[model samples]
Target: MADSQLALFSALISLLRRLGKLDDNIVLAYTLERGKKLSMLSLFYVSNVILALFALSGMNIPMYNAMRRCVPIASLLLGPCIYPQRTTSSIIMAIILITAGTITAAQGDLDFDFKSYTFGSLSVLTQALYLLTLQRMGSDNKLGSYKTSSAKTLTILYVNSVNCLPIVFAVVFLSGEYNSMKSYPHWSEPGFLFALGVVTSFACVFSYSIFLCTTVNSALTTACVGVIKSALTTIIGMYTFGGVAATPLLIIGQLINLSGGSLYTYEKYRLQKPASPKPTKKNSSIRPRKPKFTKTARNSSKTTF
Candidate 1:
């Protein structure tokens, strides 16, 4: 449903461009001599789509979310390796805390599936890479002239929608879902259609927000946002899903994760902060002196001259 909705949105945007209602330059910005940037954007979108599949694959929601808590740590570790950024002791400590919290949270779910764990780990890695790519793109001044962040986001969305169309169709065809749909005939159900629409709308908003966030902020900051999002999702799932429960360990883990994310955010902010300019010594020679008040001194000085 989400995939089809994005494809539809992309088609509409393309049609608008053809009709001269939208700017063609913005859509074609990445196509001109920016192969690396385009590849990153494609990877970002593909990994996210896969991540969504992993999340929806009947895994324990809280457990999956808890595993994703490692995103900040992964980004921090990969930062120096990928982008050669300096890491501080505070950041390392925060990463440790986050890891510990994730482990603690996972204790709540005793049934651990290896496939879900593998997918969750890949999702974290890909998400971190996506953020890193966005950071790199944002720092490149050359790309700045081509399009605004919003425009780049829209372009990426359009590309992703188009890119996934074939894969989605293939999956539907191979899985026999198309034939099953014809046999079951659920299209006429208003409730199901409405629910699907709501889900797709939410997914679109979420994807757009993520693109905007990564474009505007650093990868670490985006990871921090992910931490907050995961926490919220887990909390909501506890109430929305019957099997999900909030244990004491889970609560403690959440607090630890929040604290770690907050600490990392502060550390990153401090590191990136502009240094204050120092006060330079004033030149006494440049200042005009006050006039002498004593007449006798002035007269003596004139006589000597």
Candidate 2:
């Protein structure tokens, strides 16, 4: 673990210098200070990926998706313990609905295996932890005076990629995949390399799209898009993966699951947004009294009033 962390830190410095896109000093300082947190974050990330692979391999696409959709429920249950946020009734109801959908979907899973279900559930839990860690770690870490949201988002992407690399490489080597890849005859083929490059390029674009979305809109919008995208994927999975029986129960359950997830995101946003300071009765009542001053202040700042 120590070696992994050290390697990650070294790679981080190299990337920051090579890319010349992030503030190296700020990123390195944060990486060094929060070493333990990042290590734990990586653990969750690696675990989630491994478990998700197992879940995906063992389960059908639709069931796998349904199980993974429970991440929000896990987040709702676990988030307040760490960050102490307000949890509303609507949030709880949303979780309940999501849970019911998962259960209903499970009932319709003709090829269900307990191991796959368990692994999928575990993947969702670890993924929730990973996401929570990112939120907490990113939110608290200051990137100095010149930091923008885009910079912060890029910082996360860089740090995460670097931090996870050592462990990922270690896993691949230890699991014998490295050796297997080296022996694969077609790995050196141009078509294979071109396909790999195209996939890698798309992945980079996807990451940038996410960050750009945040810059163009807000985190809430990005998250809402994510929820909608998941729903679309689930729907597509049902059709694309012919093995999955499009039974009425399965369809209804997936719909319910998607609806619940969607509703949760929308409600979560609405509930949280209301917490921000708005014009209160007192502020409104005092507005007329300070009308001249308010007008002057607004004009001088030329900002939202």
Candidate 3:
């Protein structure tokens, strides 16, 4: 049901573009202009999503979130390749803390699975690559003509969405899921339609936010945002969801993860803030002495004359 819905959603976007309704999605033309330099971005994105879905199957909600907590670290490691930015000691420590938290939480998982962890790790690496590529494109001097961050993000989202169509279809076809819904016969059901629409809408919104944030901020910062959100989701899952052990360790772990992400965000903001110009020394005020009422300075010249 879900796979078929995804295929249908992709088809809808492609159809809109084919009808020239989505003039904003110039990814295909842009890709052509770039001589296919950006062809790998779609591949990386598709791999990232697919690996994430694979990871989700082997783990519960809390564990799933915990597994993805390492994305920030992955982004950091991969970031320098796209943009060589220096990392601060605080950021390094934060990454370590987040990794520790993830490990701690994973140890307490009630449904630990090696295959899930492996897939999640692959997803993290792929996501890091995708993010860095997208960020580089957004920050490219070639794209500096974009009027605003929103415009740049929109171009990225449109291109990525359109490019993802073929990849999504290929995956579905290979998995034999394109016809899965035919067997289930749930396509016309009201509940199925509603759920599909809701999921697809949220996914679109999520993709927009991802590109926008990644464009406005650094890839690492966007990854940190995800870590922070997932940390909250993990905390909520502990009590509400039966997938987790709900142990004190999990609480501590999420706290550490959350704090780490927050610290990274603060550090990034501080670094990006323009430094205040140093206060220049004010010129010493040299007030002229009031002319003496009985000035004697000219006496020598008058006497000489």
Candidate 4:
């Protein structure tokens, strides 16, 4: 267990660096437009690619392994759209939540296939970093022109989607899995069921929407959203798939995550009232500004005098 956590922590650190770099790049790209910026559009294109993978990957763990590779990139790409100012403590709390959730996920199937485990760890790490990046990007930074959503979306699409060509190539060349794309039913196919299910997308999309919202604390927003996604996914997976049972530990992890996020939210906004200055009476001669009408009449009387 300790070894797994250490591995995950290492991956998360790397993922955080990647995310920070991606966010910085977005800011840079806004300041200076380059041909490579065009490639970022691929981030959006990969949405289709991810969907295609789900269609053919079948109901198994390998597809998730494939998704793990993409998680970090996807999450980092989304950094620009989140709220601002991710504090160090908040980042730590987020790591704990995501890591706990992941540990819960890894409980069974001790097959210990190093490759699959590695990829899954990477994917979770990437996702956690992405959440942090969202916290970083959620702010309205007055310094950069690309601070807004239009610029952010464009930047991510260009960098992640277009730059994803290498990944696309690797997936196509390295794996026979992607070769028979025709084997999977297209969107037009009748009664086609998507692998991993729309629930995943729904949860993700909802989380992303929350990221874009004007919340008081970016960390709390992320934590709350993560908990919702993790809980819902677990519930659906346990109930529908009947593949795994929910462990008490997993429930406890969710509670802890929720508690952390709620605390942050309360801390960020609760003290904002400024104490109303205790309503102290000022003894100074300086008076409040008179009404505009009264001032105007006073000026006219002064002119007459």
Q: Name the top lDDT candidate.
A: 3
RMSD of each: 4.7, 11.1, 4.2, 13.0
lDDT of each: 0.72, 0.65, 0.76, 0.43
Model 3, 180-293: lDDT tens digits are 745878877999889978887777767778888887777877887888889888878878876677777777888889889888888888988999999998767977788664
| TM-score, model 4 to reference | 0.49
Ranked by TM-score, the better of candidates 3 and 4 is 3
lDDT of the structure predicted as candidate 4: 0.43
Best by TM-score: 3
Q: Give me the runs in candidate 3 sitting further than 4 Å from their true place.
A: 1-35, 141-145, 239-241, 274-305
lDDT of 2 by residue, 129-179 (tens): 766666665565543332555655555555555667767778778877778
lDDT of 1 by residue, 150-199 (tens): 77666655665665566666766876767877787678899988887788
Name model 4 segments beyond 4 Å from true: 1-115, 128-147, 185-188, 193-224, 268-278, 281-305
- For TM-score, candidate 1 versus 4, the one ahead is 1
TM-score of each: 0.78, 0.72, 0.81, 0.49
Give a tens-digit lDDT track for model 4, residues 73-190: 2343344454324344554454454445445444433333555455444444445454454345434443245645644533332333224545565656666655565466674654
